[model samples]
Each structure stands twice: as C-alpha cells, then as structure tokens.
Target: MKNPIAERITDFIKNYHPFSELSYNQILQVANTCKVIYLDKNEILFKIHDEIHDSFYVVATGAIGLSITSDSDDVLIDKCDEGDVLGLRPFFAKDNYLMTAKAREETILYAIPIADFKPLALQTPAVLDFLLQSFASNTRNPYDKTHKGKLISENVIYDDHNNEIQYYQPISYSTDPITAAVNDIVQHVAQIMSNRRIGSIIVQENQLPIGIITDKDLRSKIATGLYPISVTLDQIMTTPVITVPENLSIAEAQMMMLKYNVGHLCVTKDGTNQSEITGVISEHDVVVSQANNPGVLLKKIKRAHNIVDLKLVRDKMTDLIQHSIDKNIPISHICSIIGELNNAITKRVIDFAIEKIGTPPPSKFVWLDLGSQGRKEQLLLTDQDSAIIFDDVATENHENTKHYFLHLAKIITKKLNKIGYEYCPADMMASNPFWCRSLSDWNSQIRKWIQNPGDKGILMTTIFFDYHCIYGDENLANALTETINNEIENNELFLAFLGIDALKNPPPLGFFRQFLVESDGEHKDTFDIKARALMPLIDAARILSLHMGINKNTNTSYRFAKLAEIEPQNALIYEACNEAFLELLKFRTEEGLRNNSNGRYLDLSNLSKLDKVKLKNDFQPISEIQEVIKNRFQLTYFT
Candidate 1:
C-alpha cells in the first residue's frame, strides 16, 4: 500500500515542473501510486545494468551519489542532495540502469510514477526541453549526440530567476579616432587637429598607437613657448598612453580614468595598443554616460538623508569591487579606494545616526576598525570588528559621555548590519559597551593585556593590534598605537607569547602531502584555508614586525618585506612568506569570485591538480616561518 504523504509530494512537485502541466486530478492519481523509500548511509538504491524501475526518485532529505560504472568499477559523477531528481532512464528508453545510485547518508526519497508524468511532459514543451537538457548534461549518454546546438538549454532550466545576476555587456566608445605618426612635426599635427577642431591626436608607429598629444600638451609646451611648434610630436606628446578596449563599460572607463588620474583612454583593437587605434573614450564621454561618478557617489554619501540612500551607495560599492577585480586592477589599490569609500559610508551613517538622536557627540571620539579591515586587506564582505574610543571626560560627565557614545555606536552598527556587513557573531564590535570606551579606558585595557599576557589577553591583542582608523580622529589611533609600541618595546615576554600563538596552527598538510581537512563541524571535511594557511602567515608578520619596532605599516606583505630588509639573515624566508601570502590571497579572491562566498573554506575534491600543487607550495613558508619564530623566541622551553 502507498503512503498518504505521496499526494502531498505530488502537490509540491506540481508547483515546479512538467507536473505543473498535468491535470490536478491526474497529478494526484500519479502521486497515489508513488512509493516513499528510506535508506541508511552507504546503502545502494540501485546498481548499474539492473532493469529500469517504474519510477525515478527525488531526494527528500540527505544526499545520493549518482555514479557511472566502467569494467565493474563505479566512479561517482555527482552528488545529488535535497531537491535533486535522479534515475530517469525508463521514460526515454527501455534499457537497464546505466549508473549506480547509492545513499550518501540516511535519506528519504519520493519515487514518482513515470507513466503518469509522461502525459505532462508531452503537454509542456518547457518540461520536455528541460528534461532532455538535464539528461544530456547529467547522465552517461556521452555519445547520445542530440541537443548539441541548444546552448544555454541547461542554464535556462537550472538558473534561479530571482537571483541578482550582473549583466556583462561590452562598453561603448567613440569610433574612428584621429591619429598621427611619431615623426610628424608638432606644428603640422596641431594644424590638422585645429582644422578638424579635435582636442587630441594619437601618435602611432606601424598602426600601433604609442603616444598621445592632447590640447593640454600644446598649451603647456608650445603655447607657453617652451618647446618649438616645429618639434617632433614625440618631443611634446605623452608616451605610453593609457589604452582601453572598445568594449569597456561606462563604469569601467570611469574607474580607469579615476584610478590612473587620466583624461583620455586610447581605444585599441584588443585593449593593449599593440594593434591599430579603433576609437577613443574621453573623460567627458564617460561622465556623460554615468550619472554616478566618484564625485557623484561622494556627494550622494554626504547628502544621504537616510539609511536607505546609504544602502544604495553601499550596493554600488559592491559592484565597483567586482568591476575592479574584473579589470585586473591591483588588489592593494582597489582595497585602499574601497576602504576610503567604506569609511565615508560609515561616516555618513554616523552623521545620520547623530541627527536622528537629535544631539551631537558629547565628546570627541574615534572609530577603530580591528582585524582585516584595520590591515586594509578586507577584500570580501566579512564580519564587522571595530571599537569606539572617546576622549576622557570629567568624573562628573564620564558616565553620561560613555552612554552617548554607546548609543551612537549602536546606531552606526545597526546601519552597517543593514548594508550587508554582517554583525560580528562573537560580539566583537563597537556596539558592545566593553568595546566602546574612552581613550583613558582603552589605554588602561591595552596595558592590562600587555602586562597580564594570558590567552584572553593575547586574543585581545590579536584583534586590537590590527586597528586602523576607519572614522574619526587619526590622532587618537596614533596615540594609542604609539603607547602600545612603547609598552611592547619593554615587554619581551609578551612578544614571545604572541609568537607562540602564531605557531598554534601548523601548515595544513599531512605527512603524505594531503590536505588536512576539518574532521568535524557544520563544515566537516572542508579545508579551512583562511585559518590554517593564511592566518598563520598574517599572525607571524604582525608579531615579527611589532618586535622590530616598525610602525605605520599594516600590510602583511609590506611588513614581511620590511622585516626581510632589516634582518638580512632571515631575508630569504621572509621573502618566501611574502610571496606565499600574496599567492594565497589571489587564489582565495579568485575562488570567492567564482563561488560568491568568503572563500575561506575550499572544497579540495573539486580543485585542479595544478591548484593543489600551488596551494601545497604555500605550506613551505608556513613551516619555515614557524621554525624561525620558535627558535628566535625560544618558545620550545615555554611550550
């Protein structure tokens, strides 16, 4: 006898595909004939070459492994988790099952009758097309050879309609640009441009543009009578001009101009200026197309009347980050630009919050960004880790001043949370009264952590040491950093303690060079690339740099390079660490862009052999640096 739950299953399925085209009564009829099957972990649902069953299965819970068999050996093709449909061979052809289906874990599946589903497939063209495409992409019909021309058929079926997907259309630019030869006299070029009323002319060699002579060049060089008008174009022209492809978008063109601080972009055939000049995109052209230039974005931030407008600007910032990455812009430069923008957004949020409170800040205060944001290395959206520190007030006004800053921190943090920077899960944010303190209180807290030197104190230092002033007075942050450095100079034990903490997580590799994946958790079996690999290097750099009494440098790579220069004996090792850190960051950024996540956890199973090798190479520096830390700090005796 079939379960009564089958009718409910049919109702759910009917809302989604070929089943939707079926008559309500007919769907119920099919559902009533379906069977509900349960399997424990590692149990086989069906084997290859077995006679096809009367129905296919939809995973109700847990996961199933769909695999193909070759010479009696089964190779897993894909893991079908919840909502995945599997085993649909009988409807198309009367053949034995080509693959083996096994339960990846304890699972419940709903099996629908093929006979009843066939009528719906015939009635719905969308359903039939989707089924055919899914089968072609997922099944073992490598030589089935049908549906080869239907590009995006599988995408149409699987892509979620509601997700915000960015459109990647080619940029528009001015075609048929003015050009000249390198040997051409400036006077002659000026005559041609003046006759045509063009402001600039590109100078080329063998059809490849090499330089540009603009109106500014003529005014600054010739009109000022500094350079003779008879001088060759090369004498007055700016060589190695910025070049962009014809397809650059308005947003990209604007970013490029702002990034390089240039007014003209030479449009080349392939964006390299190695080929003939095809067009030009001037600063004016981009400004005309884009209503939200940097100036506009900045003004909007200033004039933002509410959190809603600020949210819109923050969303635009996310788009700009993606654009920067796609344009192959330097990640460091991108981080600085976005950091300033993010800081501006925070400032605006603070202003809006203060306005809403109907009171100005009771005292001068600074908002400090801790951890990655402090280091200016935050490339992806991560948790907010910050603190608020105000000037010490008179005893009479101390409590009242603290209360005002706390309220302000709460408002600012709330707006930040709404803008996609998730609240720190660990409560390590400015909103916490413990974090929102006066300058005197912050100094006292740092002294206690430095003197005590316990696990909690070390952890606090790890978070606080990365502090970069995101908003408010820089002098306050500088004073705090200087006080800490002065204190650290005398506290050799504290530096050793920090070094030991840095060595806690060894390189994530086992004896046989296999990845040391997490044994248990929600992310069980996944490699924690951030914690195990990246953090070790970051922690080491901070500890070593602080010990060297170096200040004002927050970047890990720059810190390591500085360390290398100061300590020539350790130069090679430090240089290797710097390179490895950059490589890992680049890898993580690429992965994050691909999967749309923090890119902290990596799926080792899906990594290419080349990437695995590259990742393993980073472990060498980790091991070497840890040894250096242990030896230099004499942590062996302490451990």
Candidate 2:
C-alpha cells in the first residue's frame, strides 16, 4: 500500500531539482521507499567521519547546517534551506561524511535512498547533469555559486598517519586590551577596570605584558585584607601570565584556557610570555564565536537588556540542551551547565527588576530559589518558586522595609513570568507577603515548620529546605542554612515526617515487575516518572542529609555523592542511587524535548524495548534507597 505521508513528502520535494526532473509517477515511485526524518533544532543528521548512510537528504522544510569541527571549533560552513540537498558527498565519494549536518531549526528531511536514485539519474539526462555538476564542483547544488567552496573547504585535510587533520582558522581578538602599569596602585587599576566595564586589567612594564589582575584577585586579596588598596599592581597581579600568539584560533584559545583553568589569555607577538602583548582573548570571546555553546548562551543572558533578549537566549539554551542530549553527554555535566545558565538567567532577571524599581533594595537582601530550582535540577521550563530575605529593620519600620522588598519581588517574578517561568501555582513566590520576609521572619518560619512538623509544615519544609541563594549576600544565606541544620539536629519527629514523605511513591515497579502507571488522571495510562521515580530519590537525599546535619547541598546527585563519602558502609547503594538519578533525569529531559512538555508523564507505549529496560533497571536503586531511608528514620511507626 502507498503511504500517504511519503506521497506528501514527494509532492513537496518534487518541486525542487533533481527531483523536479522526474515525472509525477516516477517521483512518487521513488518517494514511496524514501524515509522521512523529523529533527528537532540542533539535532545532528550526520556527524563528521560517520559511516555513509544508505541515503542522501533533501530539506523538505526548515534548515540544515553543514559544520566542520576544526580544532574543537564546530564551524558552520553553509546553511541548506528548504529544497536544498545535503549528505550527498558521501554518495559520490564512497567515504565517511566529512562535515556534520545538523538541523538549524525544527526540520523535516526526505531521505532518498542513493541506490534507487542512481538508476533514475542514469535514465534522466537533466538529473544526471545536476548530479555530475554538483559532484564535479564539490557543491551540494552546482547552480548556487554563493557557497561554491564551502563543501570541500579544508574539511578533509589528512596528516602523515592518514588521519583527518582538523583545520584551525585564526580568530579575531581585542587588540586594545585594558592595561595598567606595574607601579600603578590597586585603587587606580580598579578604577580603570570599572571605567572600561572589564573584569581584568593586564599589568605592563615597558609596554610588555608582565602580570594580570582580575576581579577575582581583588575579591580574594584586597577584599579579604590579604592586600591593601594602596598596593602596587606588581604586588597584587598574578605574575608570568599565560600567552597565546596573536593569530590564535578559537579552538586553540579554548584549549589553552581549559589547560590552565584561566578565563583570560594574553595574545602576544609569539605564543609565549617572553613575547610582547599584541591583543587579549577571554573565554567570552571564544564562547561568542559558537552561537549554540552553553557559555555563549550564558554570556548572552548576562548582556540581555530586556525580557525579549532573555527569551531569545532561553530558546538557544533549549537547542543547546537538545544537542547535548543527542551527543549522549553525561546527564550530570548537562545538568551543571544548564543549572548554571538557569541561575544566571534568574540573577539577570533580578538585576533587571532592580533597575525597573529605580532603586536598589533599601537594605541587604538575598534571592532564594525554592524546590527543584533550589536543588539545581531544573532542565525544562516550569513554574517559578522563589522568595526574598532582606535584613531585619527596626520594629517601627518593618512594614515599610517589607513593602520595598515585596515590590521588588513583584517586579522580578513578573519579569520572570514574561520570560517563560510561570508563576508558582501555590503563590510561593516573592510577590506573596507570606514568602517575602525579613531574615528573622524567614528564620522563624523555618523554625515553626521544623518544630511543628504538620502536613502543611512538612510541605513547606520540603520546599524551603532545598533553598539556594540565587543572588545577594552569601553570609545571610549561610546563616540561614546554619539555623535550619541546628533546628533539625535533635528533631526526630521532623525526620520521621520527611522519611514518610519520601516513601509515598514506592518503587515504580509492582510485584510482577510491571510499571505502576497512573491508573486515572489527566495523564491516564502514563508513567508519572517525576512524581514516582525522581521525587523518591530527591526526598531520600534531602532527609538523609538532614539526618546527618548536612545542609546547603540541594541537588539530589550532589547530596548522594556527599552521602557516599560520609557513609562508606552504604557507599555502593548511594553511588547506585546517584547513577539512577542521573539516568532518570536524562530520560525525563529527552522525553520533555521530544514532546515539548514538562516530561512528567511518559507514555509507556511510546518507549522502545531498550528504553523500557533501562527505565526498569533504575527502579531497583529507588527501592533500595527507600528501604535505607525507612530503616534509618524508623518510619514504620509513623505510617
């Protein structure tokens, strides 16, 4: 039977060349056996040096980017839009793909089998001519001269070992770096950095780069009283700075930075400290060169002046997350990068809110991210759960101080809402008077929750205990964490309630080892992966850490890692829990990207046999962890 979908794809591609050379009947015959592939943005169709697929591709819609990974720099060479042919080089050359073909946007591709197309090409003179011309010119489309050399541009260079050599094109740098003399006072160098809105200033002696002083140097030295403001640049600056040649490529610069664990590099006449400084390249420069890299997205988030700019950057982050998943990057690594980016975005939103309020907080305040965000495991966009803790004011001026912060919170949450973070459904946000409070008030609220241990109190305890300070005073956040740990140290009742909550959803598998899917709800017949699988691990980590007087480690994986270190008796189980948590997170993130939803509810029917098995294997750790939590807290009495 003829597939209607393949016919529709054929109808679309038949309007474009070399398919255009065939009759409707002939094209339909070819399309019947052709495969249709749907790709999310940033998804790779074929990677460099990957085995040649049996087919070549035509973009039916959206765009495909042909990129070359030269010296760790994935340089986008050409963009193939609708009707554009790609991956054909493999067909003509009988070798592995030289360049990667990635979806630049949500794309649909018609994968025409090369075996079937070859016969049609021989019969159709026009089709034969198009293929020969394209192959001869080393171009995807011979008619388009605009990207003539792009396909074969330094993508196939070979070394003596016959290994493909990655090309490293020189990158642009800031030639005029902000500099200060070696004899300049710390105060003066600080002034230069502030005026230029830069983080580091190169220290020079006789027009040669000598040392470097960054914001971090000042924070750790001057602010910490290790060095005074009157100290000379020669005293405070880091000596024998790392240097690269002026003609350094983006990939090489990134390598040097990573090798040294430094953020800034001096571009010199020669690639050594002995050479004169010609320019400067920072990690930011390397990041900006790659549009889809997480660092670039983070930099963009920081520079975003408005919510619209932030929205665009958030969109890019989505693509970055998708790309990371497609490459099978470790889930923990992906979480850390996305988590940092998310926090940065939240902090930027707060900065914008402060700007809109036309004034900074009247007193010192710290922004608190609650629940999943506090744990730093948020991969997909979801509701906002945040609060503010300002310094205590005089009894007479308490309401006025509260009003200032509440107003500030209102602005921030609204801005975040506009940028795609939905308002907390329970009103557990800064905009709520109950959540936005003075430091003492927050401390008291937590005390009440810990001391009382009621259902609502337990709920609040769960939400607030994982609180991470997104911005503001670190001392204030540390003090709050200290207070919470002190309150829970002797509270056996509180630990019991938390343990009871942790076991609410038992392991996802039933006695027969069948998935215990939701029987009925809006997500009928679907597996509640988040509520059942992920939350059990999160709850166990939190309660177990609380019992051991561990605070401030909100992330489940991090908590488990810490647990493993401290509890070597059960270290294997803790490590197993950590791996299970990561795998579940990866599964949920991939599902979320695939369905464009929260990935909370997973359709069991949609999963492959391998996916089902992988998910099933993770359940044992959840069961084991819950058993440990139960015995530790003596939760049998509570239930």
How big is the RMSD of model 2? 24.9
Q: Which 10-residue span in candidate 1 carries the lowest summed lDDT? A: 150-159
How much is 65 displaced in model 1, in angstroms?
57
Predicted candidate 1 versus true structure: per-residue lDDT over 228-267, tens digit per residue:
9899998989989888755565545655676567788899
Please give me the total number of clashing residue pairs in predicted model 2.
0
State the RMSD for candidate 1.
28.1
Residue 528 in candidate 2, Cα distance off native in Å: 0.5
Mind giving the per-residue lDDT tens digits that candidate 2 earns over 61-100? 8999887652233556678888888887755678777678
**How close is every model to the real structure, measured as TM-score?**
0.57, 0.57
Give the number of the best model, judged by lDDT. 2
| CA RMSD of all predictions | 28.1, 24.9
